[model samples]
Target: MFATTDNGLSGTGKPESVFISWLLWQPRGADLAVEALKEVQKLSRYDDSDPDITRLRSLFVSLAGADGPLH
Candidate 1:
């Protein structure tokens, strides 16, 4: 699992492993993952109007589960 605060992010071992399993492999570190997630959030309008955004959001939702994103 992972968490976020005003300072930044922190995660247990498993959280990074999820990113490692992906072919694209993004979660290099807490700082980078947080930056990347921020970028993804910014790009996604969250209105379900864009398939790409919807898919990305869905991926994160699935990865994060009920706990939601790192925050």
Candidate 2:
């Protein structure tokens, strides 16, 4: 299961301390793609008035494309 830290960053609960451990631990390509797509979709729904959201949406789009099917 995914767990967050007290500071809101992603955490492994011990040893490693990072906010993106889940991505590293995902077992399947399909699962990673689906999770990435969900994040992209959420970012796309952000308010137009938020500049940070625009940057985030662009970043997510880049990452989604990078994670797309290789064959």
Candidate 3:
């Protein structure tokens, strides 16, 4: 059995775990990053009222298109 929470994945433990998963799963190339950004954008379109998600969507947009060292 698993506990449920407001966030997806439920009682998986620390909030940091969700962020860590994102860090580890981040897209490697520009192409994949663009796709990832699109997906997040789609999610935002569904529910723009969530401040946290809106902020994340903004970050994705800001990072999506860029040239030269992304490092």
Candidate 4:
């Protein structure tokens, strides 16, 4: 479960990845968000061709309303 608490307000049980993606992508233009995602991809310890990473790339593409790789 995910949780956030501030000033006695709290939220929990949200998908952390979605929250992370929103924090990364919502405040910026699509190009910049995509660039940030590429940096995340580089920092990941998964295999270069991991399927989960592929899915994450697909999600970021969808978020940007575009098609192609994050790299």
lDDT of each: 0.46, 0.51, 0.53, 0.50
lDDT per residue as tens, model 1, 1-71: 85643312222223334334552555445454444565456545556564444555555544444255432
- Model 4 Cα lDDT, one tens digit per residue, 1-71: 95655333122223346437555655545565566466456535455454445455455555555555444
Worst 10 contiguous positions by lDDT, candidate 4: 6-15
- For model 2, what is the error of residue 26's alpha carbon versus the real structure, in angstroms, after optimal superposition? 6.4
lDDT order of candidates, top first: 3, 2, 4, 1
Which segments of model 1 are wrong by more than 4 Å?
1-44, 67-71
Candidate 3: list runs displaced more than 4 Å. Answer: 1-20, 27-32, 66-71
1-71: candidate 3 lDDT, tens digit per residue: 96656654233444345434655686665475666466565645656665555555555555566343222
Candidate 2 C-alpha lDDT tens digits along 1-71: 96565533222243222215545765665566566567777766657565455545555555567545221
Model 4 gets an lDDT of 0.50
Clash pairs of candidate 1?
Answer: none
Clashing residue pairs in candidate 2 (N, C-alpha, C atoms within 3 angstroms)? none
True lDDT of residue 14, candidate 4: 30
- Order the candidates by TM-score, highest first: 3, 2, 4, 1
- Give the worst 10-residue stretch by lDDT in candidate 1: 5-14
Deviating ranges (above 4 Å) for candidate 4: 1-48, 68-71
Mind sharing the TM-score for model 3?
0.45
| Most accurate candidate by TM-score | 3
* Model 2 TM-score (2 dp): 0.44
User: Candidate 3 at 44: error in angstroms?
Assistant: 3.0
Q: Which of the numbered candidates is closest to the native, going by highest lDDT?
A: 3
